[model samples]
Target chain A: MSVLDRRRGEIGLGDVASALRSLRPADADDVASIAGVLGFGLRAADLNAQPAPTPAIYDHQRPLTPQRPQQTPSHERLPGWAMPPLLPAPEPLPDDVLPSQIFRESPLAGGGEERPAWLGEAYRLLPQERATPLRHALLPARTARGVLVAALATWRTGSEIDVTELTRLLAEQRMPQRLPSLPVATLERGCQLLLDFSDSMVPWWEDLRELAQQAIAVLGDDLVSAYEFAGTPAEAQRWDVERERLVAWRPEAERPILVATDFGIRGTPSLRHGGAEWRAFVARCVSVGAPLLFFVPWSRGYWPSHLGLHPQIVHWHPATSAAMLRRQRGLSRRVAR
Target chain B: MSHYTPRNFTLPADYCFRGDPRDPAESAADPYIFSREAVIAVDVALATGRPLLVAGPPGCGKSRLAETMAAVLRWNFVYQTITSRTRLEQLTVEVDHLRRLNDAHLAARSTSPHALADRDEEYYHPGIFWWAFDAHSARRRGLPESVARPRSEPRFPGVERKPPDEAREGTVLLLDEIDKAEPDLPNDLLEPLDRGSFGLPDGRTLRAQDGAQRLTVITTNRERELPPAFVRRCVTLLLAEPAREALVAIAAVRAPQAEKTLVEKVADRIEALRQELDESGRRPPGTSEFLDAVNTCQQLRIAVDSPDWEETWQQIELVTLRKPMVTEDERSRPA
Candidate 1:
């Protein structure tokens, strides 16, 4: 019992009323407890008599008298009437029959709804697998698209009329200007998704898949071109969704390249990745004017320093958000506001 | 720059919104009782000319606020529900290429080609923003002496605007369910919303008249997170689930012919159902559903204590109050 209940014997109605008369807002709970204690000392006539409320949620308006189900079926009560069964009864299985044998004989037969009460003990607790977003996410799902949009979006001339340009055209021609297009900023140029499937990245395979999905979800399937490589990006193979085939990977000029890699760390010794082959690959990207971005799961310490700023490396970590990317680009800090 | 400073408009604190219930318009709203704080938010938005971004669950009368406010203020009302494919140009303005092309073809075919006034004003189609800014200019497609005929002003079916008199012509633009739009849609509206003006293809800026007053109200179900830039610019009002007393008051106003006892009984049931549904992590029955239940009881004459009404009442609960909610489906399932 609460300590408030222990003080019930000493407290009286006048004491409770006096406590409430000067009750400060802060001490309201104490006064409430005191008033609750005074309720115990009330007579039957002191409190007005009231009927109990109907049970809520179900049967709130149920009839007063208890109604029971009919003991006999209508067909049984009717002497001359007969009704056909809707569903055929299943043949009973013997207790000695093995579960495997039963399954082999009747593979489609699942458990019926009318199971024995004791069978409830046989049921195992199946814990639910909840899909928590961004648990294993390298790039935070909410901010992933924002980061890409800020990073790779380019300006292209649009077919819509530009008032400023139209004004100039009309002034020069000395007449009413017809429709003229203007420059519009958008993410029209799609990106290449190069995924690392080396032995070192086995633990982060799911993350790679999630990264691809997030990229696709942001840009769209047609925009996110897919490529897969075991250890070396130079030897990467581009896969097509429709033809179900793989082709040699090459960097498209002016198209941003997003690579999910670890720079060949913890791979087999024979696999010569992140070496001269990687440098040549970087050189090819530079030649083609492709803006390469590495979504490396490893920290900056693991990245090769010899690449010389040709490709930008974004730490593929949970802490990586659009704000971090913006800050990295020397943009205005949101915290300053 | 402020719309309120130069105007004679004043929103009384004691004002209660009594909309026409008998009108069967699509945006027809019953009497709305604003929470004490909601009225303050409305005042803030009104005084500052900022869009009141009302965030609430579906069917909590967020959309109806604009229509009712239109009636109360005697301002022009423009209603448009946003979808995923909604473009910013469609809201502000768009050039009628087809109409312009047809005009050009007719001018070329006629002997006196100059007879067809091939002007930019004739090809311009003013959108909701244009109408809200200056209704008169918008009717003529933003040109006073345009050769094209004036267009009909947009309005709800049964809403009759108070005839222009001493009060200046103003507008209430309702962009309902804005969260359904693409993420950039809100950000794209920053300029037009802040300045009360948008650039036209005809090299003219269609600006809000200095003498006219305007208030924009946007409602969202929060299906997507709005950009912070967009949210910060607008005054926000979050509509909470009404308390029991408020619910009863709503029912009394919405269904004035409904019996008091029946309304009370239905309100009590709604309270219990709301509690259970909230506990189960589901959206509770909102104000719209409450009115529906009360109306069902009054129309069918289903008494809470009547044994004959038991099955019918249960069926009503199944369909109206709880059918689609996941937890509600569990109760009537086979044992």
Candidate 2:
């Protein structure tokens, strides 16, 4: 598996599979192969060595010009001159002789199956559906949980390594003034899950709940601060675990915020979540150094243009994965020039 | 460029991956049966310098291949299971700032002679890459012989997975579940894996002393896509799910104590269950589940044509093969 072999996605099977060379017929007898491919039935030469021989389909085929099989339609067919003439016009009977127009009954009328009494309700009622775990889900719960973890989780410095202060101390030969910094990927700073519960998001209400659960599952129950808001995300209120009451969502420095919203796509104009509010929320998060991620149910084209580039937006879809998220965030390695 | 075969790297026909005995006495499984394709893949990876990327559904024996290779070769094994939080620095080298600070404090106090004699090299914590590349250098923590070694030795990954007390030929490094890490991790790994060296913060390079003897085997559940660049640097192998015949053969090796009839029955059931699950868009049970079913039947004295066969098999199927991901909302769904 050399670099070029992998790069081109081809292997040199010809070098190893000697049987392939044996497949070639002796003395350039490739006409059979070509004939077979071209749908030309085998010639007498192809079956020369066979003990039992069968005629090819073409050998049994009849001519396109009139032949025995087709002679009936070609010769016995009726001509225009020999065809029967049109029927004479029917004579109209006297008014008294025929039954009155209104009195004559239509034979087709009143001949039908009786509509059953229960049929109406049956038509109105839906069929009893069996439960399915995967049907109509934004993503598989397991993969969703992983993606949520990958997208929302932020890294914090480990307690150990404070290289700058250490370097200063080592150079200047002074007492320690700061803690050492050993940066380890962690969710210690926690995350704020802002779920959109507005009218537009009604269809995905269950999905919103699932998303909340996924976020909490990834970033522990204690660390995740979930909030619910209708129109504007910035005006969200969360049930504060400490206060035992709902509190307005405030950006905490170093804490990441994950928003799962549709940007009020299907709601009334008045109920739509304003882009300005999202922009403000993102601005506030940026000001406080809180990372923000938006998991939108809509495709990129349907997303609001005004949200700006600050909040990383992810497609809330089953196909959306950590690799796609990395590409979006410009975190993946430099791929192509 | 030479032709490699099973003859070059054949396991002792009885080499199986059995579970360790617990407090309660339980019958052990038979030897692991090696697939020809898997063996060929290992040989190719060994011949080539590129890392071997093994991918399959869970318990399809992805990681076991690496361990088997390690055991066969009698190499130093170092493995690391990746999580969402795994980073490139964790796999390479990291500076111990606290230790450096402690050393500085002790040197100032003039009480600890160990701290006084310590150099910048003593503060470096060599990660698995350093250990696999050159154990001697990692042991010394990149310090010269004149400098005293660090008080604590660097920790090696997969110490338990390493075969016990044998002359080591080379290293077999296993990075298990690289897919579990964030997407950037694969990309971050490309340079270090390509060069077999990683850069230190103090502008020094820790590299592989001898490249040919070392084998890097990375496994994935394919939970997510890895960077193409990272994949390009690997000899990729996708282990196909085994067939009915394969299942039976695996059972023969994995559950040697079980009767052939019993193993065949379980294999037949597994084959049916695999089709059923695949048709339903669910992941089918792999070899581990197969062994569990056969072992369960053997221990409980369940025969192929036993009384209440259907009912007993149904119960076993529910516990072993059928693992449906049912949410509370979907609990009422018909199976």
Candidate 3:
């Protein structure tokens, strides 16, 4: 047991109060005032002798007895199915940490004015063979640099930069203008630097880890980022197990497994179903771990605010996807622990 | 300085190759050498402007074929010897100390109030590909671009000596042993090869703009696959070892004094040995090897029937072989 717990166990509440009362002044003028307040010759020990109040008990049977017969409506205002009880006023959500504070602290956010970040960092561990195809795809498109810069910023700030804002910044930078017609080793190196910094420093953010798992569900474990899980020491041990499960459980290769959220009714009007069913689906998503988020549909209200009201649900952006978030979350847990 | 100038080479009056480019019929004495048909096919490709990738085993005369093309076309021969250290700038001119000094001198001379100095012209040594394009254009057109001088404006003043019109007329650029160039070097050629134009370091482009075409012949040992982008741009032709008759023709060329019986015997034996190697999936000696053996006998003055022929043959074989000898164990493995 802790020191505070043990010490508090030995002291009685009355004794502590009595001791506190005794510490008060015994000045000549205060004696009359003390007498007036305490009555006659009441001692500090007597003040401390008061008993604690007893809590009231609630009767379970009292609410069941119905007594209002005078206001009986004709045929109970037409027989009808009872409406579900209204939900209690929701507790206000805890204010999220400010984006500015998050951005300032995160190492993923890069500094162009300063020295290049991730210069000395080890990139996120991935299979070396992937460097080629990734380069091939990324080089010709010239989108790799922007994605990498954002990833670097993600590492720098240790927070998720709003992808929209990041994309905007990249457009303004016109990074592609200065680059070779085809991105080459320089682009590859930039990507490596970003991965290295993120892997060594920020690791996976919580939302991203959850998304990764959901992604794994939709895209098979053969996907490049799937192997990223093996980088962490703890996850490394589970790599084989997870890999084997995924391979065995992988859906038909011809068909992509769709993993979008219901967000209440917006995703499918016909599949409205029950709130209980939604809760169950959410629980399954949490257990499945990656990428799956339970959300209230836009039909109910828009995104973060809608998802935020439900303590059990999370907002999964369409672009970010749930499976990726799960894997990132998994990575984040490994980093945090 | 030399007697032969840009106008010395002229297209042969009788162009036989164009008439029958695909015919497999060979030169009567040497079937192993390219049939006149093959030569014509290459010529047609050249005329139509195609970059030919000559691929074959080592010593199959792929490199020599380019030399022959240069000769036949009567174009100036320019060679770039590539090594591991070869880089992008080596293939294209970049800012160097010489260029910088020239720039500084031009800036100073143009601005100085105390009468401008007539400075020595800067001769930017052009790369093999660029130089061929530039020099060839200059020779055919007579320095039209070179004659038009800029006024040496205060901002971005013109240098006294223009970049060398190193572009030679009808230069057949032979990129020999192209496999040796660094990975990214070939990709750099795409622009110049595609458009027949390249930009200079000074933000000016030198074009073969309706000038004599620069014939480019690239030879490779097929060490590795070139990038698909580069490969797609070239006319690919693969060459194999020449036949026994071709070998004899090659021998006759190399050793004119050697008896016909000796030459035939050597050719037959070499052909048999090469067949055995091929059946066993082993690398065989090239036509160069056969020529080497014949040259050795001629040099040593040994009779073909002499008992010492075997001993002398072994000694000659060692020097003649370019590729590593395939061991029996390696030959036994399925290709």
Provide fnat values for all models in the order shown: 0.00, 0.00, 0.00
With candidate 1 superimposed using the best TM-score fit, by how many Å does residue B321's alpha carbon deviate from the native?
Answer: 2.5
Q: Compose the digit string of candidate 3's lDDT tens values, residues A1-337.
A: 3423322111233432342254242453333222222222332111111011100111111221121112233334211111112234469887886555333454675665777578768888776664433212211212221222222111112121244554665789753332122212211111100011112112222222333332322121223222221111111111122111111122221221122233323344454334553344334334443222232223333332321221223233334333444454456446545
Better of 1 and 3 by lDDT: 1
* DockQ of prediction 3: 0.00
lDDT of 1 at B44: 51
Q: Evaluate all candidate structures by whole-model CA lDDT and list the values in order.
A: 0.64, 0.63, 0.41
> On residues B76-110, what C-alpha lDDT tens digit does candidate 1 reach at each position?
78877886557688787777765666667788889
Docking class of 3: incorrect
Q: Which run of 10 residues does model 3 chain A get worst, by summed lDDT?
A: A187-196
**C-alpha TM-scores of all predictions:** 0.53, 0.55, 0.40
Regarding DockQ, does 1 or 2 come out ahead? 2
Q: Please identify model 1 stretches exceeding 4 Å from their true place.
A: A1-145, A148-296, A299-337, B1-15, B20-29, B106-117, B146-160, B163-165, B325-335
Q: What is the DockQ of each candidate?
A: 0.04, 0.06, 0.00
lDDT of 2 by residue, A286-316 (tens): 8998888888887777777676667787888
Chain A accuracy as TM-score for every candidate: 0.50, 0.51, 0.18
Worst 10 residues of 1 chain A by lDDT: A43-52
